[model samples]
Target: MSVTLVLIDACAASPKESRVQGAVQAVPKTAVHRVVVQVNSDDPVIMKHAITNSLNLLKAYGDRNEAAAVEIVAYGAGVNMFREDTSPVKDLLRFLHATHPDVVFSACGNTIAIMERNEGHPLSLVDGARSVPFGVVRLVELQEAGWSYLRP
Candidate 1:
């Protein structure tokens, strides 16, 4: 009896081709387009620009019928933008979140703790803002996941 060998690339083969001689094949999964925007400045104008850039990217992807996710991470003095009492763009942030629910705003928890210690009072964050353990760590994680990084 002669033996036969058939090589198959799971990613290149379809489901029908995956089953060969009672063997199942696996395929590589594709990732969605994602971006991370980093903000470390206390300037309202800089913060606004970063938000605008994220929005513009989302709009561009939407117009092309492609799905994209955006995450804005704030650390250091930039975390001020997420403070309910001190944020100059609180209304704009609310409006943006209302319009684009997919957009995410993340604040550095470490920064918040430091600020609270200095001020001797609890801090209030703007609605819809989430706190992560560390903003730089978050950025690093996002980058490792194949997300594009922007510091505008």
Candidate 2:
């Protein structure tokens, strides 16, 4: 149950910064399941389902006293789920982030740039959502790191 906080920069030259926060009992990697959930649709129901599935998986692992990590990555129209103003599930996202430190929300910088360009203003993201250079690249990296991928 070790809690690690990581700060990932979009730039490759900047090595991601990570820190072990409060120590919870640590679990071995083999015992922990890692998942990266992809969200690319603007449909609110799809967004809700993706989040619900991730939360359920985390809860199941916790119930068994096992460890699991869930990352929800958004790009294209799906990036709207992380936007403060347009997100239909902003409160739910914030609540999940507050309760589950093992869960991560990532917003694609490329998508955000396109959105901002269309809107002609900077968009605000929900709290706890991190920016990644590209969502597809992030997915590939996560899969290469042995995380199972899910798109709901």
Which candidate's TM-score is highest? Answer: 2
TM-score of every prediction relative to native? 0.78, 0.80
- For model 2, residues 55-105, the per-residue Cα lDDT tens digits are 778767776766677789999999999999999878668667877754778
Worst 10 residues of 2 by lDDT: 6-15
Go through the candidates in order and give each one's C-alpha lDDT.
0.73, 0.75
Stretches off by above 4 angstroms in model 1 are 1-31
lDDT score at residue 142, model 2, on the 0-100 scale: 81
Relative to the unseen true structure, what is the C-alpha lDDT of residue 151 in candidate 1, on a scale of 0 to 100?
Answer: 93
lDDT of 1 by residue, 58-95 (tens): 66666665666777899999999999999977876876
Q: Once superposed on the true structure, which residue ranges of model 2 sit more than 4 Å away at CA?
A: 1-31
